[model samples]
Target chain A: MTEPALGGGGLVDRHVAFVAALRGAGLPVSMAESLDATQAMAAVDLRSREQLRAAYAAAVVKRAAHRATFDRLFDLWWPPAIGDGEPIHDEGSPDAESLEEVEPADLDAIRKMLRDALRDVLLTGDDEALRRLARQAVSGLGRADNQPGRQSWFTYRVLRALSPETLMASLLEAVLAGEERGGLAEKVARQMLTERIRQFEEAVEAEVRRRLAEDRGVEAISKTAVKPLIEQVDFLRASRDEIAELRRKVYPLARRLATRLTAKRRLGRSGRLDVRRTVRASLSSGGVPLTTIHKPHKPHKPELVVLCDVSGSVAAFAHFTVLLAFALREQFAKVRVFAFVDTCDEVTSFFDHGDDVVDALARMSREADVVWFDGHSDYGHSFEVFNQKWSDAVTPKTSLLILGDARNNYRAQSVPALRSIARHARHAFWLNPEPKQYWGSGDSAATAYGDVIPMIECRNAGQLQEFVEAILPI
Target chain B: MPLFTSPDDVRTRLAATGYLADDAIATTVFLADALGKPLLVEGPAGTGKTELAKAVATAADAGLVRLQCYEGLDEARALYEWNYRKQLLRIQAAGDGQKWEETHDDIFSEEFLLPRPLLTAIRQSEPTVLLVDETDKADVEVEGLLLEVLSDFQVTVPELGTIVAIRKPFVVLTSNATRELSEALKRRCLFLHVDYPDAEREKAIVLSRVPEVPAALAEQLVRTVRTLRALELKKAPSIAESIDWARTLVALGLDTLDETVVAQTLGVVLKHASDHTRAAKELGLN
Candidate 1:
């Protein structure tokens, strides 16, 4: 009933209980570290939140192992008494003693429902049916419609939401079940599901590979053999600063073009001076004859042609780049957007003014001619198509932007086609959405492309912003 | 004074008229009494993280203070933004002659400073539950600011220096893992990962949250949600989704989840067309 003592000892008591609660909530908190945290708390001032958090974190969480868990518990246990009444401990409250027991039977039922629902989805190609089934399954288990049990059931939900494992597994189950189901409808569905799932899985794997490369770079920073920590230190600031600066650079370029056009408008290519703007400026200055004059501000409107690789490996990056192109429609006079896997398809007509970026990207992925992307990536075939059908689209004033990972799958790099296009274009810039470190590895044809045209790495949103600045005057 | 009775009696008084005692409720009570520090919970959507925050707030008999984080959120949002115009007017009204020497510091004083959620929580005298909702949605800078305030129960505004809390408020931060928080920020807090409760706990939550609904109907509702969470989809409905799904069924006067009723209410869960088609395929609706 007495007020809890607020001394050096109080800090230890708070953290000890916090760590214990963390352990109880299924986070890994060691006994040794718990003691260390308690000791450290007594030694340090608990008044500063930063100091206390660091001390507790240092004493308890090891590595990145339990960092996330520690963050959650700190918010709940310290300063804020969430999910509990009374800021201070109430020893007399018996409700604070034990945890309620988990029921295994309910969990099993939910698991079974998940399996059945997934099985139905794979067999029938019916998403609505699956949702209905899922709803029924969860409801039967004495839980709410969206809640799944902890443990494996939770895993099942994550797989469903984030990972395509469940859907792929279910599709496989359905395809296999076709032997018993019989006929052409089942056979066609199985074939379609198999092809789609394979493409999806490959795309996911490629993304994982990209992440692995980034992780490798981060790892190399600490090692004695590679770039040191100082080199890595300014990367966060450099990216933001560079993106901002790049936007500024484009503004001047656009202004110059706009001035030249306005000058031409007045002088009519006579190479003589036009005094209209000068006259207007002087009048505004009350006959003081101000030398500085105001000219028309016209935006630099260049012709743009974007060739994006819609191969499964680079599909995610391509979607975003294409969306950027659509968003940048205002600055360009004409924009030609093409998607290629093994062959190219001109999808310039798909974008309309004021179309939602997300909706457009989703539609492009669903409706774009995926024929060039079966299983293998063939840059040779793609380039051949570009030369044969879309050669006339490029012009002297056109800015050609090619976005891809540049993995040609050991096929011909088709440098001749790219060179031909570069001949007509003002500048041919290859924006590879892959790390510069991964430029030459494996099937990547980035090195070959880099030799012919200027290639810049465009990965993540920060890089995308930089790319936008480089291409368009904002 | 209340007599010491059975555990059920204590739970009933805590529940008060139709609420059921669940694991989260039990854990909150136990931890608040045992540890004396606030509990922070992180989880995927629909995992009862926010609900736990609310429940704890209710149990403590303290007012709940929430701060919702988002992109481009600045210090003025989480802490305080000064009433510059008012201060300027005050400076003007006090006459320019004596103001420079006597009231130079007064214009930028605490009177002109408006307290934000973080600062307000510190200043409030009554017990309060401060919920920093969706902390991950906030930028890394905001997260850093949060670490400074949550750890100390005080805010340091350069103009005002340090302002300590009269009473420490209960704190809970929830995240959906939008981005990785800095280790510096994470180090200052205890962490709890709340996933979707197991079927038993989920049942308890459903019943406790929606006691007016029939028990049979509640079980059916829980079972259906468990099943839906198994399929691959863009938007996996959360515990909130589950509650809505149950309510939808209850509104339709359906005792059980049938295929017909599900088709009619499919919009409540699967949002995307592809998601719907994919879910339907797996559930064998087509």
Candidate 2:
């Protein structure tokens, strides 16, 4: 492909294409914004790539969540190919000599070599020596000529070369042979050797993966490198790492919402002329108009009661939703959070004294009076308990938020309990992390609960944010 | 006269006013001034959204008209309101001498009108900077009011007729991205998102704002702040707060940002107690 020209006209065309690419990536960019970006580009110094990228980002990208996608697309569009030449040099052939050195004829010789390399290092706990041996084993055993998709093959070979299993066998053999005979030294040495062997295997595997990544072209690696952006990640299917990332993003999201809410609250007073006061003051000036008075508009701070299902299936969603609600506690006059699995319990006090939502959730799961360690999720029972014990918590002024999958495990779903709560609350909403397709599937009472409370599909952070902004008192 | 001739000019002028403008910010500000379009700046708090408007006002030697937006913000507060007491006085004064038509005309004249920030900015004949701080905080209805002033730089009073701008003011609207602003409002303005500065730029900011801060200490402070930001804290220290931290360190006679000093003075950078405990734990202070 021909490189786009770097002049004004060329840059504008490149920008248009770049915007198209952004749009293809699911980022919203209007034609007007594209034109504004073209105008913004003129004021930016084309010589500096960082400046150009920032200018485009500022002019085009709207939401923070889209930034990662924007950056990736920017790099692809503007390759930055000048000074940064291709650095990956293909090692055409694996060194035969090093391969032969590691390929011993007998398992005995392999065992001897492993023992020699690790014995002293394990006894003395020398991390540097252990690392060097790991690198040597990885290079010696990991053949570079393996097929493109055989990365696991290299990792397996490197692990076998380190021979953690063999090392464990030898250590066991030594201990059984009574080398240190019932002494604490023997026990400690055995423990140290076991830990060191595991580390050695892990290091060798990591080295192999690093080399494999290098073997692939930059484009291939980058394609896999771009994570499912947080906004798009399905909360129901998110991994532990993705969930952690989502948790980190929650605070900033809540803070932005809070700032907007606070600004709204501060501006809550209407500027309608207080005619009564204005007229009363005019009387002092002999009924002549002098100063106009404005009535201060007092914003109603909604009382929030969040009912979250903290069961195994929907705990991740509950964790994030609860964290966001607590973070925005200032926007409401009162906020009460309840977590339930089979039994319902008020967990608002856990967050009352601390800002660590995760820590508080952990404490609630372990020590809260309402939680039972049993894994079953009974929405009917939980709602019944809530109605019997905490019915007074929901008032006509309260905005009741229920965060759960509404899975009743094919048990009784007391829709009346939910209806009563909804009747007492000003507004009630159920945010289900499950997609709409799965809403009424096996064990899901979402359809039944839907009749009493409106259920919003909140399968991701983006949807959750939209729900919050929509429901938040203006 | 245009406030900025080019992007570089924007940077230099803004830097002269003690506010460091990044390339994106400089370019956006320059284009906004050149095109006479309102600039919509959205970012996290303490990233210098409001400061940019102040810098532009200083650089152009223009009068700064600020309207702090919030929910329930009405046109009367943002635009103009007739001085009721003054109008009443005029009506009482003209009661016997003039007809109802003449008195009604007199009450709605310029003398009886109290101009708010939007109207004041439009009325200024000289160079002026109009800052609508935290526009996202205002109700959605406020965006409708702003659309008229921003699009045509004019306001219409029922009795007085449409009053167009004598000299269009440099308009800057800031938001914390609290809520998605109306699409129509976003379309009328040039958008800019001013995120936290990078390490090198942050160091420059600290040095410029708090000159008394030693260079080495400032670097350490900025590094710590960056590290703190990486943690999942409720509120990360903004650049302004980072500068304040550097100043705090200088004033306390602490030449270094060792663990103890940081542990003690982290409050300057981190506002929440939970944040303090978390940072202290992360830094191995406890």
Task: Judging by DockQ against the true structure, name the best candidate.
Answer: 2
Report model 2's TM-score to 2 decimal places. 0.71
> Every model's DockQ, to 2 decimals?
0.04, 0.19
lDDT of each: 0.59, 0.77
Candidate 1, superposed: residue stretches over 4 Å from native: A1-341, A347-377, A391-412, A422-446, A453-474, B1-41, B44-46, B70-77, B80-114, B136-141, B157-161, B284-286
TM-score of each: 0.51, 0.71
Candidate 2 local lDDT, A192-251, one digit each (tens)? 456566667655654544444445432343444345678778888999978888888877
Q: What is the C-alpha RMSD of each candidate to the true structure, in Å?
A: 16.1, 10.5
Question: Runs in model 2 with CA error above 4 Å?
Answer: A1-13, A42-48, A82-232, A239-245, A248-307, A327-336, A342-346, A369-402, A406-430, A440-456, A465-474, B70-72, B83-113, B157-161
> Per-residue CA lDDT of candidate 1, range A208-260, in tens?
22222233331221122121111121222334334333322232333333333
